[model samples]
Structures are given as C-alpha cells and as structure tokens.
Target chain A: MGIYLPIAEISVNVFVLLAMGAAVGFLSGMFGVGGGFLITPLLIFYNIPPAIAVATGANQVIASSVSGVLSHMKRGTLDFKLGGVLLAGGIIGSTGGIYVFAFLRRLGQLDLFISLLYVVLLGTVGGLMLVESVNALRATRSGAAPVLKKSGQHNWIHRLPLKMRFRASKLFVSVIPVLGLGAGIGFLSSIMGVGGGFIMVPALIYLLKVPTNVVIGTSLFQIIFTSAYTTLVHATTNQTVDVVLAFLLMAGGVAGAQYGAKAGQRLRGEQLRALLALLVLAVAIRLAIDLFVTPPNLYSLSAADLN
Target chain B: MRAPNAFATAVVLSLLAATAPAKAQVPLTEGIQIGLSTDNVSITAGFSGADLTIFGSLENPDPLVARQGRYDVIVVLEGPPKPVVVRRKDRVLGVWVNLDSETFENVPVSYSVATTRPLQDITEPNSYKQLSLGASNLYMQPADAGDSPATIEEFTAALRSRKAATGLYSENVGGVQFLSQNLFRATVRLAPNVPVGTHKARAFLFKSGVFIKESSAQLEIRKSGFEQSIFRVAHNYSFLYGIFAISLAMLTGWLGRVIFRKD
Candidate 1:
C-alpha cells in the first residue's frame, strides 16, 4: 500500500530524504546552529514549498538539538532561569509572528520580504564579525588585550520595572525586560519559522550581559521548549510533520553535532566567530540576489491545488 | 604605532585586492548532445514499450556494445493527467528489464502487453500487477444506475477491448498505454455508458527509478459551450505583509549580529 502525502508533484526516495537530513545535520553540528536557515533553502531548491519546509524544519530541529543540549547540561552550563525569561518573551512574540506569517503567505510577499531582510542582516553582520575577529587576532599577536577593558556596566534591560534575581544564570534582571526580549525573539522565531536561538543567545550574553558559559545552555533550553511547541502546533494544524523525514535528518544531525562541538572547542573564539560571520554573509548575499535578480525559470507550477 | 608601518600595510592590502580576479565560468557548449525519436512499437498491458535510440556520443560506439552490456530506454505510461511512468532499462544477456519503477498497487482489468525486445525479468505474481489487460481490473469504472448514459463496467470493457485490438484508445476516459519505445500515452477515455461532463487529465514521466517529469490539463468532456469564472475579493491585506516585513527585519538583525557582533 502507498502512503499518501498531502503535498504532491514529486516523489522522492527515503534514502534521498535521509541524505538531505544528513547534509543539514552536519552543517548544524559544525556551527552549533539550529540549521533552519540552510535547511529551508535546500528544501526549496529541491521543490518543497516554503510553507512545508519551514514547518517541517521546526520538527527536525527538536531532534537535532537533543544531543547538543544534553552535553551542555552535563557540563553544568545551563541557566534555566534566564532561559525561562527569554522563552516567555519568545512565546508571546511567536504567537504574534504566526499571524503575520500566515498573512504574508496569503499575500504572496513572503519570499521578497524574507530575502531583503536576509541581505541587510547578513551583509552587516558578516562584515562586522570579520573585522572584529581579525582585529582581535592582530591585537593578540601584538600582546594587546583581545577585549577592551571596561567597567561591567549595565544595559537597559537592567533598568526595567519588576526586577527579579536569577541566581543560577547570575542575573538580576527586570521581568518586563525579559518578557519584552522574549516577545521580540518569539516573534522572529514564529515569522521566520526558525528557532532564533542564535539571536537569543547573543542577546542574553551581550545585551543582558549574562556570562558566556550560560549563553549556549540558556538558548538551547529555550529552543527545546519553543520548537516542541511549534512542532505540536504545526503538526496538529497543518499535518506538516513527517516523522520519517525528521528521524532521518536527526540521525545525521546528532552525529554531526558531536564532531562540530569538538571542532568548535579547538578554535579560538574570535576565529570561529569570524568564520561563521563569513558563512552567514554569503548566504545572505545569495538570498538578496535571488530577490532582486530575475529568475532563469520565470514560470513555475505549484501542485498544492491537486489535493 | 609607527606611521611608516601603517602606510606600508595599506599599500600591501591595496595590492592584494587589485590582483584578485573573478573566477572562470563553465560554458554549456562543451557538453555533448543526443537526438531521440519515437520507435514505433506497442507493449500489451502485461508488457512495456521496448524501442528507443540515442544518436549521440555513446561512451562506447561499438555495435557489439549492444551485447557487451548497454543501456536501453523504455517508455511506460499510466493513467491520464499522466503520472510519468518511463525508465532506462539496462540490457544484460540480450534481455531488457525495467530496473526502475519497482512498485505497483491494485489488481483489476484483464491485460496483455507485447514488446520487440525480450524482457529481462517478467513474472505474474499475486503481488505484481501486470502492465497489460490485467490492469483493467483496477482501471475499470464502477457500474452505473439503470438508464445511466454509461456504466463503469461497460466503460472498462470497451476500453479493454479497444486496447487489445489496436493498442490505441479512442474514447477520452482514463487508461494507461504504451505508444512506442520512446513514447508512451496514458489516456482518459470517456465511457460510452457514462454521463456527460467536464473532466481532468494528467501524465507523468520517470527515469532511473524516479519520477522526473509530469504535466496536467483540464478539458471539458461535455458537448457544450465553455464555462469559466474568476472572482477577486480585496480587503485589508497589508497587516500580514507588514508582519512578514518586520519578522524579516528581526532575522536580519539577528543575522547581522551573528556575522558582525562581537562575542
């Protein structure tokens, strides 16, 4: 008996699906990333519609993050309190973002909007990271401090109403601020159909000034929860989750993440950031070009109506 | 901290930038091409079409290459709105077997399919649905009510009979047929005992055990003037677009930090 999938037009093999999962898993593991950025694009390249790709990527991310989160927990690096604060904000933001996501999709403006944003963000981020990391390397060689010396000054997040102390994460932040941050991150996650942990982690570290050690752990905790929620919602609503596909990708991702984490350990913090920045920039530029440039194949067909 | 050193470094950087050149592109003309035409021959429902040729750069152009082991193209067809069913058959020991397209479902219709080349592996197992008249069991239409224009049973029988005689379908109802070695036709023949109305058709092609191409068309099977309609309702739509725009901005912000933000 044949299993019927809602989306049509292409019938791919189980092995091919697994290989795609493996490729994305390797990249995610290597970078300590959620892999949605790359996975969505690759899926689109293979003719999977964007809506399905984003929803399905959320499913795969839950499993991909398992091994990475476990290792972080084992090292006693998690800051559950801080993660909870951000997650609260993110959840609200995601709810709002979903509304926007569905709206844009119906209007057929999703691709253009996504591409433009990627271009601006990627180019700026890549350029800045490359410059900073290279400068840090030069400074180190010259016997200068890698980071500028400064008073441990507080940021705006510290000044908001309803202050609460987070003992494990070493933070005494305002509840309102945490909620606001979570809301913003949540919105992005929902709209982009990505985990948004990469952004949330940095915000916690630099904006909130949480210590470096807790940054990854906190992000993973939040990611685990948010993605689980997203997966359940999309599965129940759109029936988009394909456990077979997700499992294949997860198997590859877990193995890749182990190696990636090890490799990450060997690189200097500045060097790693610089390399990652370059990669982000490249993808951003490619996406931007796609938006502005006329496509080679101008006419296409979608099999969605076949149902 | 020295002025001379800074000036020297700037010169070196400028020189490096000037020396870099754009990478070379691969030209498409360098690739070889091949021509293909339909090889006339029909395979019964139990068989597959077995004539196809490629007059291009064969890796080994020797005529003995046919027996020395080579690839032969097979054209297979199924149902209207053609779900592509074709594949490349690798010849071994003078017999061609479709290594592609491995699965078949449903059991209906009586069938027979004949081909010019000897099939490599041919068997009629309970699980295997034959490509010939036997397929009518599945393709056959359901019985209609009394005084109905056409009954499903009569439609399947008529199509089955036509297929047995000429390997060509005249009615516009749904059935699978192979026209030539390189070309296959999947048609939807309207049953003589059925009602009159518009219907849809589809076709698909396969290569190397995977579906490679497909096409679909909507045709009115009725004998009447065409009916068409288009409705557009415009309302407040920018809110969603605005949200997408903002979400993208946040992603960009996050990406920017990822690339440029200091750790």
Candidate 2:
C-alpha cells in the first residue's frame, strides 16, 4: 500500500515504512534504546529528505520512549529528580539545536553536518561498547568475576560545586554535569533526531557514576520529554514532521517492541551489548561511506528560502 | 484623341481585371483559442502523473494549408513561478559539500509541453527562442546578473536537466492532434509532484513555419484530500498541530504498551 506523506510531500510504500519501523523497534526493545538514532539514518537511506527524516524521527522516538518508561515506572527504578534536572537543560539545548538546524538547512549543509555527526558519534560509542562487552564476555568465559567500578569512588565530576543528592540512585552528584549532559543529549536529540540514549546510558554509567539499575529508566524518562520538545519545535518552525509517516512507524515499532523485549530476556547482557554495538557500527560505517563516495548528481535544486 | 482616350480606358479596365484575383488571393490571418471545461482541477492523494487533455480550435484556418499539414500547434502547461536555488557539490577534504549555488527568480515550478509534431520539425529554433515556446527556450533569469555568463549558462543547463529528470519539465511529441481543420485536442502531462497553484495552458499556432497566433487559459490545480487537509493544518496552525502530533505519539506509545505488555 502507498500513502502520501503530507509534510514530506511524497508517496512511499506503507509496508516498507512499517517494516523499517518494526526492525528498528525490535532492536530498540532488545537493546533498551529509543531507536531514534537508527530510524533517522534509515529513513534518509530510504530517500526521505534529511530534514523531514530528522523531524519525523524525533516524533517517532516519543512512542518507544514512552513505552519503555512505563515499564521502568512500574518497576520503580526511575529517578524523577535526576530526570527533571536533565529535562530543564534539555529544553534549553534543544532550542539552540533547532536554530542551528534551521541555519544549516538554509546554508544547504544540514545533510552533510547530520551525516558527519552520526558517523563520529556512533563510531566512537559503538567501538567503546564493543571493546568493553568483549572483555566482559571473555572474563565470564574464564570463570572470573567481571571487575566493577565502585559507586563510592570519587571522580572530578563529584568534586564539582552545587551537588544534589538523587535518593533513588543513592548518589550525590553535582547539578552542573547532570545539566550539561542533559543539554548535550538534548542538542543531539533535536539535531540528529535521536533520544541520545546510546550516549546517555553510557555517560550516566561511567561519567556520572549513576547506578546501572536506574540509568535506563532515568535516561528514558528524560528522553521522552526531550524528544517531545524536539518534535514540537521542528513541527512549528520547520513544518517538517510527517505525522502519517511517523504513525506507521510507531504502529509497527510498538508491536515489535513487545516481542523483542521477550526475546531479549534470553540473552546475556554482554552478548546483547556486543550485538547492539555491531549494529550501531554498521550504521555508522554506512553513513561514513556516503560522505566519501561521489554522488551521481552533483547539482541539486531547492526552493529558495522557503518561508 | 478618341483613340487615345479609348486606349486609356481599356488599359484601366485591364489593370482592374488583373488586380482582382491578386486581391482575392489574400489569406485570412489564423487565430487559436483554447477552452477549459473547468477552471480548477482537484487531485486526490493517489494522484500519479496523468495526461490532461485540453480541447482547442484554430480560427480562420486555411483549408489548403491545413491539408498540407503546414499548420502546427504546441500547447504548454506551466505551473506557478517561484525562486529556486541550484547548488553544486564539490569534493572538499574527502567529503562532498555544497560549495557553489546560483539562484534564479520566477522560474516555473513545472512546465509540460505537447506539440502536433516535434518542436524542431514544426518551426525554426530561432522562432522557439523568440516565442519562448519550449522548456529549453524559456529564459531563466538569474537573481544575480553580475555572475559570469559562463557560470549562469552552466547553472541554467543544470536546472533544466534536473527539472526534466524529475518529470517536472517534459515534452511529448505528437501529443496534439487535429480532429478537424479547426478543432484540435492536446494532451499535456501533469507530474505526480506537480505544484499546486494556478497553471497556465498556452497554445501556439504556426502557419507554414511562421508564428500565427497564440491562446492561453488558466487552470488551478489543487490538492484536495485528507493529506492536503493535514498539510494545511500543519502550516496554518503549526503550534496546535505540533501539540497534536506530540499527543498522538504519546497516545500511541501508551496504548501500545498497555495492549502489548511483555512484563
């Protein structure tokens, strides 16, 4: 079936979009990520304009994040205070990112900038996760316990001024790093159409020393609002959000997510992380290749300064 | 004197007789007229490219010339004009970047041409340039005239080729056929991504490779369907639309979790 996307002003196969969404959703569920990072690039590869892809990806992230957050809320692993502080910074950063997005679009460099950001960020994050997971897996196979970071170990981040205690995570951390991390993720969310979960989860674990149990829930909690804000801004300013496209993806994503979550339970954490790392690395490599390869058509046309 | 006067009268009579057929040989100037059944066409969401048939007539056409296939007609459907920027990507530090750009003002969003014969066979290329009849002949005015002629020419060629590739600018040979000496039907293409605005349908008449007359009509191509309504809402009431989109996402998320809870 074919459906016309109002904002994108194009007709795309409904089944292709649904399947793309389902595949991304399955991975997101299996990996406990928002899936925005995957969807935006996939949409671009599928020939959706990068601007619309980014905005619509942000819109679709809300559904998966909300679904994930609900499970976390029920389990009582969510840190509301930390999530709230992150959200405060996210709104500000997202606002700035939207301006930059519009500016780059006008300059006709938004696509390049988006691809570059994805390649750099995803490649680094994926590489680090792969190495860490492989080491952990090796340790387990050798009948040795995996070395864990002590929660009480003090880092420079803990020394920062104006520290606030997060009761749920059982930690006192400076508001500055928390707010800064939130702001960075927020920026990425608006610009890259990602919930920044891949970055946020690891950052929370290593940088902020947030407890592993509460990290995913708290990251997801903040991601829901940040992406929601990003969607609203892109909609109002760029008018690029295609609800029809977003809806189809969400429908497929939500259904696939449930089954994926069930399937994920059978896998060990290290194996799951390794698989997700490979997936991320693959996407990053794909995007990087496009940047270097010669495009068939060098000349492109667009409406001049669409108002 | 009588002989001379009679000779003069006879000469005058002969002159009048000789000039009579010459005066009668004057051909009537041909005129063209096109009419549309409706001023507006509403295209639904499933609108792929379709051929629009326009009925027209040649007024005061000479039967002898029409029979010889000397009468040619070219019909063009031009969409609304808008400013467009064409950018060229250049390899920089192993990455392709949009490095150069040229902007053209009042470029037609779409132009589709239908002709009784091939454009080259119907008339001289100079005539096409003079009338700006075909897509290739249509002048694209650069916003910055200060740019070098070579650069402007390059960009203009690029723009036209890109438009042609996208099916926005097209030419159909023998798309116009004469039903009778005076009546003709033209079939012009409307691309799937046709711009929604007032489109101008123009027909040009040629007699023996000479420009005779031209007629034009206006058509409003509107996208009318559920998708169009959503587009309107998104642009007109963007704030509310944004809120709605967010709410819809949240609803879908909550519902999906409720319906398909794994734990």
Candidate 3:
C-alpha cells in the first residue's frame, strides 16, 4: 500500500528567499551600502519571523562586507588608524544598543519602535541623499570638481577640548566629536539590527569630514565588529544565531560582492551615489507601503506563544 | 461578445466558490441518547434494560416516542462505592494496625455491590482508578436481567488499551472523577504531537453485563506561532542574511573611497 502525505507537511517555495537575497545583494552592490533599510523589511513582508529575520540579516551583512573591505584595502583607501578609533566607540555603543534592544523586546514594543525608526530615518535620508547626489552629478557634468564639505564648522563640536589629528583621512577633529559620532552610529546599529554603514558613512563624510577613502573602511571595520558581537550575543542569549543559515547566506554574499565591486569600478562617484540614493528611496517607499497598507491576515500568533 | 460575457461570468462564479466557506451540516451523533443525573445518583440510557416499558399519556397517545430505545440505569444502594485497602504491620505493642486501609474500611459491615458489568469493564475513565481492599470484603455481581451475559468484553478491552496507549505529550482536556456510582468523567488531554485539526473522543458506561450509555466530545487543535518560528529559522534565515551582508559591503566600500578622496 502507498502512504500519502498531507499537503501542509510540504514546505513552501525556498526560491522566494533566495530571490529576495539576490535582489538585495544587487542593490547593495550598486549602491556600495548596506541595505538593511530594505532587507529587514522585505523579510517581514515575506512573513519571516521577526527575531530570526533580524539575527539572520546580521549574519548576511558579515559576508557582504568582507569583499568590499578587501577591495577598499587594496585601493590604499582604508584608513586603519581612524577605523580603529571609530570602532572602539562603535563597540561600546553597540553593547549599549543591545541592552536597549533587549529592554524593548521585554516591553513588547520593539517592533513598533523598529518600524517607526525605519520609516522616519530611511525616508528623510533617502530623500536628502538622492537630491544631493543628483546635484553633484549635474555639477560634475559641467566640469567642476565636487567640493567636499568640512565637518569642523559646528562651533559646539569644534570647541571641545582634546583635538586629534586623523592623518590618513586628512583631518584634525576633536576626539569628543569623533567619539560621539561613533557612539551614535553604534547605538543605531545595535538597536535597529543594522551595522549602520548607510548612516555612518554619510556622518563620517559630511559630519566629521573624514576623507571618502577612509569612510568605507572605517564603517566596514565597525560593522564587522558590531555585527559579529550582535550575532554572538543573540546566539548566547536568545539562541537565535543558526550557523548553517549564516554560512549559506555568506556563500551567496561573497560572490555577489565580487561582482558588485567590479560593476562599481566602472561607475563614476556621482553616478554611483545617485543610483544608491534612488535605491534607498525605493526601499524606503516600499517599507512605507508595507506599514500603511492593509494587512492580509488580521489575526496572527504572538511571538511569546507561537505554538 | 456573448462568449466574452459568458467567460467573465464564469470567472466571477469560480472566484466566489473558491473563497466561500464549505457547508457545515454534519449532524451530531444520531443513534445515542445519553443523560446523567446532577446528583451523580444514576446514569440512565434509553436502550439497555431487558424489558421495555412504554409509559402512555392520554393526550399524546404515542408512547413509542417516549420509550423507543432500551433504558440502562446505574444505581448505588447507599452512595458511591468506597474501596479501602488496609496494610497491616506488627507494632511494638504486639498488635498490628492496618495502615493501608482507606477511611471507608472503618465501617464494619460487608457490602454486596451490584454493578451493570464486571469490575474491569466499569473502569472506563482515562485517569488512574484507585482500588482499595479493607477488612470488610466487597463483592460485585451483575444483576439477572434481559441483558446478555457479557459478550462485550472485546469492545471494553479495545477502549482500555486505546486509553492506556496515549503518550505523555497528550493533553487531558476531559476530566475524570467518580461523581457517584453511575457517573465517571471521561478525560482525554490533547497531545502536543496532535496536528492542528479536529479529533473525536468517546466514553461508554457499562452496567449489568450490557452496554448502557455512551458520550463523546469533539476537540479542535489549531497551529500557532511557535511552529512558525521553527520554519522561519530553519528555512529562511540563510537567504535573509546573504542579502544583508552584500549591501553592507557595497555601502562601506563606496563611501570609503569618497570620504578618503584627497583635497
């Protein structure tokens, strides 16, 4: 006699997950930025369980950044000294962020806070970055060098004592200012389940006046540290990190990064920034739709009692 | 034009049929009539006694409607049967007291208990049944009635084995209790391994060597979020992480070059 299996026993499409991963990977490559602004929300859209989705996204970031970091290092663009300083603050800030995240989870308000932050931060930044990049591209086509802005203009930050020279990034900024920036980025990274590269890279280039060459390296270093710590912490505390899942994503990410870097080489800085800005705007819009649109399923299982 | 209109109508009809809930007209058990007294004195069924008595009403005149099936009743002469087991050990005073005896054993007269069937068949409830033997001997025998002398042993054994085979994960949703002689709570705990679906539970009471009353309850178990967690992590995490890592890498590399550009 033949045994029959029930339909529910079969799994849904796995390719959906792989396709989403590839799409996010393509955007991340084109923009030269982390797409947590997009990836995390997409996971939720696909009905992935939130905690596992956040933890797994962190794992994927680790893979995605490795090749990008290597390419920047090879280009003599990586500022190791400044990267180290920003990283120290990022580590402390991320640790604090984890505590805040855990506290929010206990209060049962983490998802609300995360969604709100995504909408506000991603929307504003995406719009501003897009407009600025388009202007830069227009300016470049007219044969003018895009003038980089100075960060020490803020009198309050400039007035702080203990100024330090960042030789590789070619700036002399106050240690307090750098530390404050690092800490803010770290906290955001930890709480939002992101490495905060998209946020930090701009803050470094515009807020702190770190040379563009140093921004990616420093951000990558910080992300590598924060995400590794976040992954380990989530694993030990929530038992959320699954190594098998991490490895599979890493496999795809590493290859994707290589291809992305090659494509990035052919793009002018202004063109790349404009494209990235558009991508971020698109992701931000998609997330807004998710938040405001009517949900298909009104009744859902709570996280605490899923069974 | 007519064909296109017909196709659109067919599509609309199919969509409505697909979304509508299926009809739910399954009737409750059709053949059994079960009733229990509130005081737990007796359980009476319509179809168990040897001779049927049809009580007549002048106004209605159709007595068969009132007593169409056999009636089986469970009765306790005094109250519920109390089994007491006493354990005896010699004390330092050279007199042994039965420590294992239940409080019921203190009453000194032998009680002749008449039941519907053998002691084994009466043990229908799923919970552990405590049987006690005391100084006074207790005897149980089936009454002589029109009921057959116990060909239902096979059925009782099947039920007992099924009840005993339930695994540890099973939930005991129905309660078990000896409310009185004729009443027992037929308890079944829904098992964790049970799929999210509907299940049926049956409880039967026997007396005087015949099947008397059978009662049943339906249980519905629904799948919840915990099950989804296993699927999300087990299947979805890898792809999620893959995309996140790649985007982060690109962001860092591009921004690194721009920030580091020389004056």
User: Model 1, which residues run further than 4 Å from truth?
Assistant: A1-9, A13-17, A148-151, A297-307, B1-263
Window of ten residues with lowest summed lDDT in model 2 chain A: A146-155
Fraction of true contacts retained by every candidate, in order, equals 0.00, 0.84, 0.01
**What C-alpha lDDT, on a 0 to 100 scale, does residue B109 get in candidate 2?**
100
DockQ of each: 0.01, 0.65, 0.02
Best by lDDT: 2
Candidate 1 chain B: 10-residue stretch with minimal lDDT: B226-235
How high is the CA lDDT of each candidate model? 0.49, 0.93, 0.50
Per-candidate alpha-carbon RMSD to the true structure: 27.4, 5.9, 24.3
TM-score of 3: 0.54
Ranking by DockQ: 2, 3, 1
- Tens digit of per-residue lDDT, candidate 3, span B109-129: 111122223334444333112
Between candidates 1 and 2, the one scoring higher on TM-score is: 2
Q: Give the 10-residue window scoring lowest on summed lDDT in candidate 3 chain A.
A: A1-10
Restricted to chain B, the TM-score per model reads: 0.22, 0.90, 0.25
Error of 3 at B72 (Å): 18
| Tens-digit lDDT string for candidate 1 (B1-263) | 54456456545544654675232111111121233333222221122122222232222112232233332222222223221111223333432322322111221211222212223322223312332222333343222223244333433354445344433333222233333223333323222211223222333232222223333333332221111000000012223322332333234323333332222
